[model samples]
Target chain A: MKLETTIQGLCASLKSARAEQKIIGFVPTMGNLHQGHLNLVREARKKCDVVVVSIFVNPIQFGPNEDYDSYPRTLEQDSQLLETVGCDYIFAPSVEQMYGNKPRLTNISVSNITADLCGLQRPGHFDGVAVVVTKLFNIVRPDYAFFGEKDYQQLAVIRQFVRDLNMPIDVVGVPIARAEDGLALSSRNGYLSEENRQIAPMIYKTLKNAEQELLQAKPLDEVLESIKVALTGAGFIVDYVEARSLELQKVETFNQDVVLFVAAKIGATRLIDNLQVKYIS
Target chain B: MKLETTIQGLCASLKSARAEQKIIGFVPTMGNLHQGHLNLVREARKKCDVVVVSIFVNPIQFGPNEDYDSYPRTLEQDSQLLETVGCDYIFAPSVEQMYGNKPRLTNISVSNITADLCGLQRPGHFDGVAVVVTKLFNIVRPDYAFFGEKDYQQLAVIRQFVRDLNMPIDVVGVPIARAEDGLALSSRNGYLSEENRQIAPMIYKTLKNAEQELLQAKPLDEVLESIKVALTGAGFIVDYVEARSLELQKVETFNQDVVLFVAAKIGATRLIDNLQVKYIS
Candidate 1:
């Protein structure tokens, strides 16, 4: 496996791959790889001739109060993990290498998709994702880019902008990978204390319950309210528990496909999860 | 020359060009078939194996009070003019095709460079230029993109964003095309009356005089003030007469290359022109 740490090295490798008519697949990640990230790479391995995984904890995506300083940087171990997954390249660029000393001034924003969901709670988050992904897509020029459905809104925003900007790249969304206990895999899961770790599965459990209620054609409001009650009662600060259409628009009825989204804080770590309800009625 | 009015048609042609290993050059303009626009396509013709010129009258760039409705569009003349200049394709997508009924939510903006000049004069103008050009570049996948320096600040913004976004494009800035009277060629020239057109050359003439003063190391503030006085006395409502470094930053000394920029309105028609002073101290 090749480890490219500079944009120059990455471009050179990509140029030769393009010349040879290789189908390149890309997975961009923040580098504390777990089962979910490995799953994305494995998916890429199944389809593409060359798979590149970019491990960058984008500073611009983090808010002032968010954990920019404490984000993990285990490059050595991350490289070992990716190598086991049939990855061709690990692009791990330093912050300076990616953005340089100057502040990034170009903003690639998607208005509607970013107006709600995590966007409401975290202003400028999706814009950060949009701009950074644009830079990565241009630099890598991948045939296909993989994103996990755990960041469903992010995937939606990326898809929207890729179409809007007419960027010639196909975006693929891999399903969310969860533990046997139903806890969603996340880099921040490392910050969970022993007690909070045990309770974390309750988030997925509640989402599953909400999914069942939604599947049975339960009232959207009552089921969503029950989710908030269940999580808040479990010693969580409910950030939001809401239901929207498959398109992320507010759902008035369960006539079509709908998704229930939840974000809540346990102790100090915030966890988010969503469940899509494919309705029959 | 082929005329492609849809993204699909343009992409198909570009795909074949890439298959044959042809280098593509792009020139983007809003159509009125002015000498300045043709000059840009001519530059692309000399360097690239296939030249694509896009004529898009972007609506988002126009402020509500500005003349989006009155903008001249002569596609027939523009196509003939491009064919004469050796252009390979003329992409003239309808506004609906370029941006669907839905609003284009992506904003590719350069903040520092766009903070002054026409950006201050016309809010969201460069951002419109930034986003639309981004779409065209992706659609064309051009090896080299050409711009006329008649809109000097617009070229600088495009260069900065292309660099910032890591887009693999070589941006070539062709020198401005002017008339015998030294008036910069522009599509907006169609809006001027015969009497106002006769006086419009004053904008360029004043910039030439200002360029002489800067080349001779004249006082920056005094020389700029004289430009405003001369144009205003000629019955033109001066928008701004200022000097900036070649990098588009305010200049305090003539120790480096400097450019004098001017914009003035005569009888409701706004005309802008600029001159560069290659100073050696």
Candidate 2:
């Protein structure tokens, strides 16, 4: 298992592997490796000749008021966990090394789709994600790249970008790895207060209830209203409870290609979750 | 020479070439192949084991009122020209084939540099160029890509984009190919009347005179004023003339990385040109 820090060093290592026609499977993440990230690495290991897991807490992706400075930097633990999971390389680059100078530009932005969801809440957030992912995709040039569906909207946007730009890599999306209590694993979960942490599971529970209600042919709007009621009842500030197309970001009335997405503020910590619904006649 | 209109066929051909460790050189053009495009193909043949040329008159780069429909479609002639130049592959895909039912919603924008120059006059022009270039780059996956400095600003923006995004491909800037009369080769030249065609050489001649005058260490503003005077006197509508950094898009003093860029309207035909100048104290 090689541990590299600079882009040049990592490229040197991968160049040799590429010469041998080795298929590289990459999982790019910020360095707060939780079960969700490891799950992506595990999936990569299962499919490719070489596995590269990059831990870059890309500053560009964080907004000015976001937790960029306070974002987790547990590199040592992340490296050990990767090694335990039989990972081939861990690329840990400094902010300067990763972004040489403030990138003078941004890349492929999905329009109104992103404009509403998390995009509206965190302005320029998806732009940062799009730019950094493009940079990483170019740097790695992996045969396959993995992303856990824990960041569902991100997964959708990236899929759109890869197809839009015709980037030649298989974007393998793994299912969201969850805690035993059904809470989706996230790096931000570490910021949760002990009391807020107790209520985090309810977010997922509300989504599950919405899914069950929709399964009974409840109107899409009514299902959303019910979920909003439940979340607000639990002392949460509901950002939005809406149904959108899984592939396209269109607001759906008939529930075709629909995914119920939710975001709420639970005692100062913003949490998000979603459930996929297959609408049937 | 193989002619492929589908992405799959091109991919297969390029993939086989890659397996043989062949260097693929790509020249992405907009189909009405002139002497300028032939020069690119010839250069690719000289330097690379395989040459791939893509002819896509991208609609994204054109303004709402621009000549998307009137743009020349000389595919048969273009292929014959490529074959004469020893080209290996020609990729021509329809807009529908290129962008599926749900076009992937990603943007690959260059930056502030592009937003000026042609980008300023033709809004979203560079964005379209960036997106299509990205798509072509991915599809061809060429080791080296060629661009004509005839579209001087576009070449500079692409260079900046590839550098900033850390994209892994060598971008070769080929000098503008001109006619004996010093008129720059452009497909759009066909749109001009015979009288306007005769006066087209003035665009190049004016820039040359500006280059000669600037040898006296004249301020850029003065140089630009002189060029604008020469252009307007020649019955041309001068759009803009300014000295800007070749790397950075802002106005810069002499001895910096700079190029004198100009855009003008000759009758109904719009033309752009530039000259790189050095300051010798």
DockQ of 1: 0.78
Q: How well is each residue in A117-165 modelled by candidate 2, as lDDT tens digits?
A: 7888888888888888888899889999999876888988888888888
Q: What is the TM-score of each candidate against the true structure?
A: 0.97, 0.95
The candidate scoring highest on TM-score is 1
**Kept native contacts, fraction for each prediction:** 0.82, 0.82
Candidate 1 retains true contacts at a fraction of 0.82
Q: Write down the TM-score of model 1's second chain.
A: 0.97
| Superposed model 2: Cα runs more than 4 Å off | A248-257
Pairs in steric clash, model 1: none
Against the true structure, whose lDDT is highest? 1
Off by over 4 Å in 1: none
Cα miss at B163, model 2 (Å)? 1.4
